[model samples]
Target: MGIEWAEPGSSGHVLEASMRPVDSLQHSRATPVRARMWKFSLPLRHPETGRLFADIDHLGAGLQRRSIDRYMWLIHDRDEGSAPHVQGALRLSNSRTSTQLSSILGLPSTALRPLRDRSGQHGAFERYCRYLLHESPEAQADGKFHYPDSAVHANFRFRDMIDRYFGLADSGCVPTAESADQIRLKVYNGDMTPLEVHGRHPMIFIRNHKSIEELYYKGRHDRLIAAALAERAALKDEDARVPSTDPHAA
Candidate 1:
């Protein structure tokens, strides 16, 4: 409810994830030798009835939208946490209808032009209407997904959030340590401090929305920038580890 949307996996911040800030994770305490845990059970009192009817039919996939919580719970039996959902969450807004649907989805509209601008992860974009009209919920139904509009428009802004959340930066296209050290050395030799250096990076700017300490992740650009800077600094450190080639010594 804090940041959850009225619809499942719809537009809005994920409530669960927001509650626990990433900064706190870095300073988590070690587990206790033994901690007391308790369990409790509550009984649900319903009206007098011989049996309860299962709503399996009402549960299957159709066009029913609920808050992300109810939806993730239905799929994984656990919460996937919440994400920020802005107005861009809904692509069908009356005013934004004219906006390029492809851009919103983070894909070039012309990229699939030969196919008539058709899109569907599992093939639903063009066939969406067809599915709704012909495919009954019972006979055959498919699910369609779209990225948050903010990502398409302001991807750089959420770079930190995306990288940390997905853990892709560490293993994926990262700059070498030498590169990181070089960046750090450059920043140090320049007229800027660490804080200033971070400020200048595109990634930092994106994550440093309201405050630098408590930054909100907008996308992956931040990770890329940070990695590059880090690699430069690491490079400089490597160079320093060995003695400089001295003409007077062997």
Candidate 2:
């Protein structure tokens, strides 16, 4: 779905302030145009009941996880639409047993030494048994999904993602016209060139099992490295612009 614009003090206005991504917002507060947009993956469909469910959930309190169960549709872009990249869209799914549980639960920052190590570790079956037997009566009585560990983990990840995704190179500073122009040039240069015509229907193309695996492992790593490099460049530029107060400033 495209971005939803909300008026200040309107019924759905709560999210508008945080979702803004454009510099023009400050100059014209009364404008109705959207300053930013977020891309959300299309829903996963069920074959039995023909119901659709979102693949990703952005539950506000730092908890974001792919749906535990859903069917994903793979479409092939044989017509060169996905040129620079070999694929169209890939859906990420998360399982309850995934090893990422601990970080998600905020165990790393907890003050309790004993419980910190156990929250998100692979010894889930053991942990569950331990909680059932040794945990305080109040914690044991709470539901599994809403338990203190799970709640803390979700909030931790949510806040971290917000900072990573929405934060600018410098805090409390709007982007300058020159910097905005540079960003536009990068967008134009870095993006995949558009195709003149739509490619083959996804059903017609055959799938390569090996390519998919390579994309997940090698391609994903390469993209992450590129993102790191971009962030480093931005930080370096920001550092260079600081005015030196002392002549001997290093």
Candidate 3:
């Protein structure tokens, strides 16, 4: 006898088999993302010296994203009306968790410090930073600053490595007149180069509201925010409904 195959739509058994795989898949779904926690040591400057430094044990969680640049002379001068006065600003620098920068650059951390105050169009720091990447290193030892282009985000990663051990010089309103003068000597007139700023306030990734907000898209952000609030309210309602276990009183 010749084998007779059922028409595609006529076979209930075939459809059931097809849905079995999907049904099995539904039971093994992944868990939703959980909030991340982090820690960071609170840093402060010496009231007198304005020297900045942080010990090893600081960590904070935030959705890791590149911070926006700010604190330019132009921004300070323009009156933006309602924009919040520049309460503060953050500067990013390249750093290396790898020894690649150190091995290639030869200059390492110590050499970079002396040139930290580069500004006024011809600062030693920028020159050295660019120079090392080009002149030294492995196969491209002669390339010099080859990575500074958009591909490497300049020396940001290398700069981040330097971020590990850094110092700070306070420039904004000071606690006293003497301290203010010290800042003037140590810090630029709110024009400190990005390197100096980075050492002062090392990049932090904190898992605060901003981190959560950023993870969602523009429209989704609002919806998620409202949903989270509602979920929290429902939890509170559930807590209120739980019966107390005071059997003796009853």
Candidate 4:
């Protein structure tokens, strides 16, 4: 069963879903979680800087500490030259209703949208991951896979965290059809090829020279490579001053 949305009213958006007990037997099955996933989007601003919220790491950690089972946050501008906003999905393991979850997140009820997957399809979490990362078949066919510079804050590590939480393993065995599908969903939306996606983890690929050049420097690969090399040399020089036995030595 999936979430059913209430009709719009003066009360704003209200999420309604049938609650299901945590099925222990499902753990042995291929499906991920029995819990439903809710997507949230809200504008957050830094009071001092007048920019987007910049402490997503702290926000994510706080949510996890509050017993949120799994979550992923993506910060991006709403439009060209517009202020950035935060959007993501979360899975609740407890009995808290959607209203309660919104309260805990300091967001109005309208911000939450319950995700529903088609019959015999991937779980809601996987669906949201593909949609947000622009890896879904629909997104690919439409050529709508693009994110702004603010998308640099997109947390790919959370995908790995969610996989681990669900006990999904990435064994280095030969790729099956299922494994190939998983790789497609996990590939970055940037200019990376399948070979590159297979070679590096998503987290590392996000911050590597190629991604930095394409995302931030507008594909100035040569300039970016030179800067990266210079920075590495400077870091080595700084490391030489540290004693080998020092715990802080790089």
Candidate No. with top TM-score: 4
Model 4, span 139-211: residue lDDT tens: 5466644453245333345444333322332333332232232444344333545456535443233223344
- Candidate 3 C-alpha lDDT tens digits along 1-250: 0111121112211122244565436523633221111111111222234433221121111112333121110011121222211111112244322122223222111111112333544323333433332312331433322332232222134333222221121222222222222322333323332344234332211101232223323435556778899999999999889987888856
Q: Weakest 10 consecutive residues, lDDT, candidate 2?
A: 196-205
Collision pairs in model 4: none
The reply for model 1, stretches above 4 Å from the true place, is 1-6, 9-161, 164-195, 198-200, 213-250
**RMSD each, Å:** 23.3, 26.7, 28.5, 14.5
Show where candidate 3 strays beyond 4 Å: 1-121, 127-230, 233-236, 239-250
Q: What C-alpha lDDT, on a 0 to 100 scale, does residue 111 get in candidate 2?
A: 9
**Which prediction has the highest lDDT against the true structure?**
4
Worst 10 contiguous positions by lDDT, candidate 3: 68-77
For residue 11, model 3's alpha carbon misses the true position, in angstroms, by: 64
lDDT of each: 0.28, 0.27, 0.27, 0.49
TM-score quality measure for candidate 1: 0.15
lDDT of 4: 0.49
- Which residue runs of candidate 4 sit more than 4 Å off their true CA positions? 1-35, 44-62, 78-84, 140-156, 159-250
